[model samples]
Target: MRSQKLYTSFGILIIFIAIFFLKQNFLGEKYQDEHHYLPTAVFFSKEPIPSLDLLKSYGELNTPVPFILGGWVVSVFGENIQCLRLLTFAVSFALLMIFVWGSPDHSKRFFLCLAGLMIFPNYYLCSVYYYTDIFAMIGVLAGVVAYIRKAHGWGMLFFIGAVASRQYMLAFPAAIVAYECLELLKKGFSVKQFFTGLLTDKTWLPYALAVLSIVPWVLLWKGPAPAAVMTMQYYDSDKLIQYNFGYVIYSSACLAVYYIIPEVLITRNLRYFIDFPKNHPRLFIGYIILIGALITLFPAKQAYNPYFTWPYLGYVDQLFMTIGITGFFKQIVFGLLMLITMMRFFSPYFNLTSCVVLINILLLGKAQLSWDKYSLPMIMVLWFLAMFDNHWLFTASNRKQDKLFYH
Candidate 1:
């Protein structure tokens, strides 16, 4: 990471490879849902200044920001989806550069972080399409970069853009708010002291602004998201509150597959299985009891999941089912793996990345649907934290915790 040669050369190689397969079926578009969004973007292109009525529909449960921006680009370059996808690839590439440069130092770990992101199924792999996720993630990664630099205003601005790009993006800013609030509680363990601490700092302003950016949408839609596509996801704008406790467990299992599985593969000590019980006996017992209760109550493949036909359980569950694991057995496997995932990464050293992951998971639990790509932001933050070697999960046991990881 110190020298640009390796980084630049790798990026070039990737672009060259993508170009080689640009016209082939290697990266097929069967699952990609550009039809849902391209029309909305086209609408934005023709009507650069959309009216209030137009804003009401708001492009298949999306905010107007990305479509408007995408429309502007498409108008200038013609509606070549391939060209637009190239632009998305460039945006993802820019995010990679930001992560590499915005890291506290240019350690080899920074390069590792870049490599991890490039290979992620949801990151660079999805960049060769005319989708809006790449736009949202840049806002997220850039905001995290601002957090690293302690630039409150920049973080707020970036997060505001993120929220406009995708409503779920509120999680990043909200995590900062939660982390700051928790840090304030650490200063004085009282309600009055915590409230005073919150008011006493300029750190919360940016996140506050970013979170509040959703207020107008909430008011207009009369719910968290647009009503135009609510029914498709088995929701009603009139009554958006659907209490599905099962989703929390299902999403945890997905997190285990996406973040925990990769990390465990990297650090294959086998001590996770052996020492977890020995190190934290009571927690282990409680984990077993809790897993038993949860599996009985809220297993995977929920009735409320609109994507029941879709492989929303993620890769691990799909693999299990493919290999003759299904029903109660699959849920039990998810329960056990999820506990290991939660305990391993978020134990004694819960920091910024931990805050991001927990908050995102909790928020997703309430979402109308869940997918592996929803975990992309969390995975990205984990990689960033890994770059700085900031927590116990990243082999930072001997090193002192970095100040950037506080709370």
Candidate 2:
């Protein structure tokens, strides 16, 4: 009974903090993508549903769903940024609730999952203003939550909504597709059986439809996004021909440092990362060769944009720079970590988390720049999937899924 009271007190305090954030947001609104977004939403308020031309009217970088939703908020609530910000907070809160609702394990794992949403860097910050990451993440995540819960029809709609909000969200559905196919193959399905499942599987259809949902927007804009906004985002027809391999390295390193290291330390799963190489020397040699080549040829290039002159790639690079680490030495250290991280996922078996995380990472490789926020879709959902699958987080239970950190 006392523990229950303590939990209630904590919940009340969290509510106060949220209220403080709501008020704090109104005090001083900062700039992110919102400067471009707000104007578009203001125009969209009168229209409510955007015409293709209208979506392209603002120099916004991505899809129109967030603005369309923002427009709806403005239309009903009147033209107040404060209203929109508060509503965005509500949307973020709803996302938390939905995630908690859909969690496979409803024990303390539910509360444990909140840490990722509320406390992860720049995660809760999205709710304070009109930043689209939380909104975008929620859409994809709602679909993902629904998908895992076997609600394919709802999953299809939510995923479509997500892709409508942001094109990068395609990664979720694509990862689902790849993971499902790999699962089938692992279960002794032949190539012929795999091809047959694509036709027969209702589960597969939702992802296919979700992927296809991007087609109309592609046709409307003549590209991944509006051509007008593409220029602003440093994307062009020429960019379609090139890949950002630098991001490939940077993102792989991020998976190691940001995602893997935390879980490893918490679970004390360092042994797997250590022993994997010795057990599989041939794979390690191949990985080392690949990393050596990639690092030599296409090392993580620092973003030159004046807004982000942070000396190197995203968070890890920033940390190293703070500690006076830079240049070739930093590259070698990260390369080794990156090698282990990628190998960790690849070894043992095909992992759903690895597939999704790597797919998100690969998808972001096409992005103009990499930021920690770019990783939120994965971070926001990745830990929950781990928790739900009965992985290392909150490992007090007997309901074990796997012996290792990730299967």
Candidate 3:
């Protein structure tokens, strides 16, 4: 009844947002990163597969698959920015649908969250601007969703597609491995059910395909090995390590609070939290940390001073500033939101606020806050969580159905 209407309205809102982007071609921009993909596509009349020499020379570092595909796309569509931008936007939209449909047990709150994700100023702005990163992110999320559902074949396709979209997506594959390993350890080997199949066969298939797929890059690029090594130098960089550590710690702290805190604080009862076991506070937090750190680490470059201009700070601070003029406004808002949500009565509103605050923290710490590239996943995760939380507000006690969701 009320919940269903909320879901429908949210879906409609998503439609409106997509239409808005479609009308303006989002925000058109010059071909970014390497235009090599386009030309390569033209050359092969197929998605350009990376050459062996290219990978060998570059330490097989960073996936070159996306470049190959992008090149092929330009060849098929004719060399034009409009065609490329449309492809990126289409992929992003497709990702949203995949997130919604791919999960079998989604709730009304998930729908609201979906709407929130679509309307994110960051994602909205990026769709207008051309970015390969967004496409790769779509593949990454798709792969994760597929894997979670036991769709191994499709999962590999997505995982490979993601890495090909961007070389750095290796991090996603690595994370998947870790997640799968944990699941395996908990459930134990089950050859009969084929859960073990993922470990023994399907797991390594992508690496093999990736290796074979990237051969073309090495053969073609004849690029400098030093440059490739330099690209990977972040693994050894202290500053990068520090940032990664901070992100890990902060994310873990948030998740611990979300998971450990009794629902009674938010629901005025203990049973709801126990019932809605599918809330996945832990998974949600881990996903955030994994995605956030990868985003920070992989991008070759970042825009200067991108965080100072975020609009949410003013909105958040305004609420807090009813008391005073000076202080870290974002922190004040964050504290207030946490406190309110901690008190069960205002949990629904506060959950949404907490998501926004987390997003802001992510955006603020990073090199840039531009919608052209970053925040696509942040928007998706936030909206998805918000919508799900909304539905949880209605149920007297969490059911098994409520616990199952796309992790």
The C-alpha TM-scores of every prediction are 0.87, 0.88, 0.51
Per-residue lDDT tens digits of candidate 3, residues 335-385?
333332333322222232243334333433432122222334433433343
- Per-residue lDDT for 243 in model 2? 81
| Model 1 quality (TM-score) | 0.87
Find the 10 residues in a row with the least total lDDT in model 1: 398-407
Alpha carbon RMSD to native, model 3: 10.1
* Winner by TM-score: 2
Regions more than 4 Å wrong, model 3: 1-47, 53-62, 167-375, 378-407
Per-structure clash totals for the candidates: 0, 0, 32
Reference-based lDDT, each prediction: 0.70, 0.72, 0.45
lDDT of 1 by residue, 292-397 (tens): 8888987766443543456546655567889988989888888887787667556544556667777887787776666667778778877776766543233244
> Which portions of model 2 show Cα errors greater than 4 Å?
1-25, 106-110, 305-312, 390-402
Task: Kindly report which residue pairs in candidate 2 clash with one another.
Answer: none
